[model samples]
Target: MAEDHRHETHPEIVKRLKRAEGHLRSVVEMIEAGRACLDIAQQLHAVEKAIGQAKKTLIQDHLDHCLDDVVGPLARGQRRAIDEFKEITKYL
Candidate 1:
């Protein structure tokens, strides 16, 4: 059987996502209101930055807990976990 290695969503992560959602909604409203291109672009940049920060936090958490456990002294599962983390980093 495959090992189940899902990380539970931390409360702070959820809060950050909620705040991002609000920012996204504002961006949508700005678009609908025919706001200037530069203004909309600025808001989009803010949203992207927030998402990037949140992603970094989540990645750090995974590295600390899941990856550390997988890559510890045994080294048996290290390669696979490392490969997975590399794949995930590509998207970010």
Candidate 2:
């Protein structure tokens, strides 16, 4: 992870990831304790969704703020590059 830009949503993202981390730990413990598979799967799904949402927020923030800074009267090539980068992040 690199930090060339910081946004207001960053703290919120960290909070979400922390919550996901806690949930993951709980899932691990539940597995060790012989919890029902259904219960463990539900917790794992929550953690997965939490992490996915955090990633989406981070990428959207970067595109909205960081790229916006570079969008002013740039040459065509640079703009295309930025667009390409934005497109690639969609896969994340």
Worst 10 residues of 2 by lDDT: 64-73
Give lDDT tens digits, candidate 1, residues 1-92. 99965566566777777878888998999999999989999888888877877887788778767766766665557567676775687566
The lDDT per prediction is 0.78, 0.90
| Superposed model 2: Cα runs more than 4 Å off | 1-4, 73-92
Off by over 4 Å in 1: 1-9, 74-92
TM-score of each: 0.66, 0.74
Which is the leading candidate under TM-score? 2
What would the C-alpha RMSD of candidate 1 be, to one decimal place?
5.5
Candidate 2 at residue 5, lDDT? 65
